[model samples]
Target: MQIKQRHIEVFDAIMAAGSISRAATQLNLSQPAVSIALANLEKFIGFKLFQRDRGFFAPTREALLLQDEMAQGLLVLERITQRVTEIRAGSTGRVRIATNGAMAINFLPSLIAAYQHKHSDVNIDILVRSSRQIADWVSTKQIDIGLIDTPVPVAGLDAKFFNLECVCVMHRDDPISAQKSIAPPDLAGRSVVAITGQHMVDRQLDTLLSAADVTVEKHISSYYFAIARNIIASGGGVAIIDPTNGKADLNDGVVWRPFSPKIYHELALIRGSNQELGKAPAGLYNLIDRSLQSLIGIGNAGDSNE
Candidate 1:
């Protein structure tokens, strides 16, 4: 006769409980069933596994020798089950991302960290690139996903869009921070961090200043919003930047306020339309989208207060 799995469980339970009645209770079986299983197990193994002494069940020398192996086997089974659960939850995959340096700085990092906490087995990689190159990056498979501040219309890539407005990024103690929304003339003669890379946003700001007849006497030109933000934090000057990028370094004593005439930053999440996003990338995509929605709500609330 063969000793089956039920026989081993019955033996283990009896050893653990020290009696047929308690083993039955633990296994949700009747005392008679537990006794029968123990009897069958002993008969199959050709040995007496337990001994009755003064109305209590005691494990014999042979039973004691097998107990540790039984526990280890059960532990291995439990681990296998846990690994299966993690796989089903998509917690063991990899997701590679490319995005503008601004997004890499703040909200995206927070979002990625929170996701990774839940999915410790998942691997994540981030590549920082200019907004202009994000489209090509995704299309060429340089990254599984691309997050950009401006739309990129590359073939074989699809864009899911989200909107946010530019803000006046400044030191919290700056006199301009007192106002909820900064006016064009308020920045006149103030040192300003300017983007002179010929980006459309820079051109738009130039036109706005030109139309307002305002001049920023001191201008520091930079290609990266992150660099511009750092300048502002270091007491160089205030900057016009997207709220997402502007608020990325709140701990640096920088605050973002609404601009008088809003400048909308067109942001898009681009992925290869032909390729199916794997579990990790898809989950991350949904998370970033939800975060952007929340930010838009906060921006609207701020506008109401202004």
Candidate 2:
């Protein structure tokens, strides 16, 4: 019979303890069991492992030669078992995440930092892609999690939705910065930095402006909220942006004011419909949920000068 784990275990114990009785005690087995295992190991290997002299069991030349290799092998096995336990506990592993531009720049990095503070062993991969691409990645299991604008363009993927009130972001030096809130008329004839594509926020802003008979110059436009905030910081003009981006740029020479009449930026946290999040990803997912809930709770509280 081939040498087995138990045989090697008993052999190592006897070599360390120097006696069958002590080896049995180390392994929590009867002396006969330890002795039997050692005998079988020696028989399988065709060599005597120990030189028994009365009570003392001295390691034979063959035993000494095998000791180092066996010890190294055992160490490898122990480490493998430990790593397995860590993986099963979600204490360590790689988490692949993808997101649209909104959360990718400022929000996700901070969230990831907080998660790594608690779970230092986890490896994280972050991908910045369009919401539709993120949805596709999540559905195909290319990513463990995805943060994207909703409604999720891809069906059959599990998605959690978050609705955030869009805020008007403007240069700190602008006169509108002093206002507690910005209404559609407040933007009339203003040089407006618009979000280029007519997405949800743009459509809503357009409807409000039209209803208010407001005509704002929209010569400057961008697709990403952070980029728009950058343009606004450079005195480019005002644009409605999500609160997450607003919060990220609190100290970036731009101010966020509540925009009326309450346009909401809908977001989705997505993952494969068929997959359950592992411990590390679940921890991050829960953290994101809590952070977004905190943002929603803040409401107009996101208004800040610095």
Q: Whose lDDT is greatest here?
A: 2
Cα lDDT tens digits, model 2, 142-203, are 88999898788998898788898888888889998898888999998998887867888988
Cα lDDT computed for each candidate against the true fold: 0.79, 0.86
Candidate 2 segments whose C-alpha is farther than 4 A from its true place:
1-4, 300-305
- TM, every model: 0.69, 0.93
Query: Lowest-lDDT window of 10 residues in candidate 1?
Result: 297-306
- Model 2 compared with the native: what TM-score? 0.93
Given candidate 1, what's the lDDT at residue 103?
Answer: 75
For residues 1-306, write the lDDT of model 1, one tens digit per residue.
776666767877888889888899999999999889888878778889889997589888988898998777666766877878877787878888988776787668889999999999989998888766878878887788888866475778888887777778888788888887787898888888877566556667777888999988545888777788889889987988767777664588788787767776668888987888877888888898888888877654454112
> Relative to the unseen true structure, what is the C-alpha lDDT of residue 115 in candidate 2, on a scale of 0 to 100?
88
Off by over 4 Å in 1: 1-84, 303-306
Cα lDDT for residue 144, model 1? Answer: 84
